[model samples]
Target: MMIKDIKNYLKSVVDCPNWYVGRIDGKKDQCIGVYPARSQPKPVPIAIGGVENTTYNKLGVEILIHWGDAPTDAEEKAQAVYNALYGQNPEIGGKRVIKIDLNTSCPVYAGVDENGIYEFVLGAVIYYER
Candidate 1:
């Protein structure tokens, strides 16, 4: 339930036109976590935690975004994400989110290709009440 709440929160905060719940083929310029092509930006992915903390109802959520052609692009996008969700406790569905903190964010390798395409990952923990 927390994962579902996290995903729903992401769908509300993220500005991307195409949003995927899981990894997408990286063949496109962008995807949730999959790589497909590089010509244009594709869909973005939001990965949810496999296991939840029954004691606290905490869940790990990650958002993958394309870095675009410049380093500023990546930084800007990262800032946008942080600006959108950090420290804001929004009611997701019937659950009240206690907090959503930015855990970690950095550039990640795109599979084995290691191309020059820009990409960064935003990690967070969403805590909610059951």
Candidate 2:
């Protein structure tokens, strides 16, 4: 619904802050055992990995691809930024985690700019806010 809502929803799905920061060179040095698949719709959503472990009904997959896949100072800290921009936990502990897998198609990224800021996209399973 809203970026804030999405943030909180994502956090709820994964125990981590639900944020990612980094850049990618086309699935280069992303992670381990990353697979690729298509979701649906005419665009053919790409399924990188399993959804956030903390999420249910796959409310995450439907999330638009943004906030990640960019350059930032810290990758993990990006989650915190994402949270602030997104939403806060309504009642912490209500949900322990949100899990998403980072498949090949949806590889995470970390900016290799002069500043060397890390970034990432809302990957599938492995591509979570951890």
Candidate 3:
């Protein structure tokens, strides 16, 4: 499925919750093409906390998996997403990422990892904005 499809799928899994989507960088402020496209890719760990076991947490906060060497197919990306949110598959690289949507049902932040496996990947989670 494409990024669009993933958005819908995330809604179902995150209890049909809604979340604000955006691209992020590591240990830095959230960005959305604010700079040039060719600008540095944030030098791995585009996310802040650094993907591992800390990015995923709470009912929200998901990471947008990104890939570079080889873009993952729709099925592969979907499965990886499932594992990240549900924490089912401990695949090679599926860890919590930085900046959850805070608006989605599961509030999974959008961003890639150091390896670039989850390129253009999306995160989800339900947010309880105050």
Candidate 4:
């Protein structure tokens, strides 16, 4: 569900038409893939009566941009994704996203794949209400 939410959000923001969730479809050289990285639920404070409550979930998301033989294009696309998502809070799939913080200052350049596709990786922590 979180991956779908992110994929939908990215679809609205990024220009890429090929967006995949969970895994990258190698058929398209110019595409974006979103997958879950590291994630955990955030525990909330206990009430005065000793009842515990949890309202938020922290999800780590990884976005991979692949551009055929175009390292600059891949990096630029990753940067565009970063600019669109970093520090932004928007409701995605009816979930109230509290914030999004990128793990790196910018997208990391991953080496070209065997198919000669240049790839860039972007990681982010998305905090949203459950």
- List the global CA lDDT of all models: 0.56, 0.33, 0.33, 0.84
User: What range of 10 consecutive residues in model 2 has the weakest lDDT sum?
Assistant: 28-37
Q: For residues 1-130, could you state the per-residue lDDT of candidate 3 as single tens digits?
A: 1233334445444331123334434322221111112222222322465555322332323344332334344225444445444533222112323323322333233445553433333334322111
Counting clashing residue pairs in each candidate, in order, gives: 12, 45, 36, 0
**Where is model 3 poorest over a 10-residue stretch in terms of lDDT?**
29-38
* Highest-scoring model, TM-score: 4
**TM-score for each candidate, following the candidate numbering:** 0.62, 0.26, 0.24, 0.86
In angstroms, give how far residue 9 of model 1 lies from its true place: 2.0
Residues 40-116, candidate 2, lDDT per residue (tens digit)? Answer: 21332434664444233222222222222343424454444344323232322243233433333332453443333
| Candidate 3 structure lDDT | 0.33
Query: What TM-score would you give candidate 4 relative to the actual structure?
Result: 0.86
lDDT for 39 in candidate 3 is 22
| Candidate 3 ranges with C-alpha deviation above 4 Å | 1-59, 73-78, 84-118, 126-130
- Model 2 residue 125 CA deviation (Å) reads 17
Off by over 4 Å in 1: 2-4, 32-56, 105-115
Task: Give the C-alpha miss distance for residue 101 in model 1, angstroms.
Answer: 2.8
Between prediction 1 and prediction 3, which has the larger TM-score? 1
By TM-score, how accurate is candidate 3?
0.24
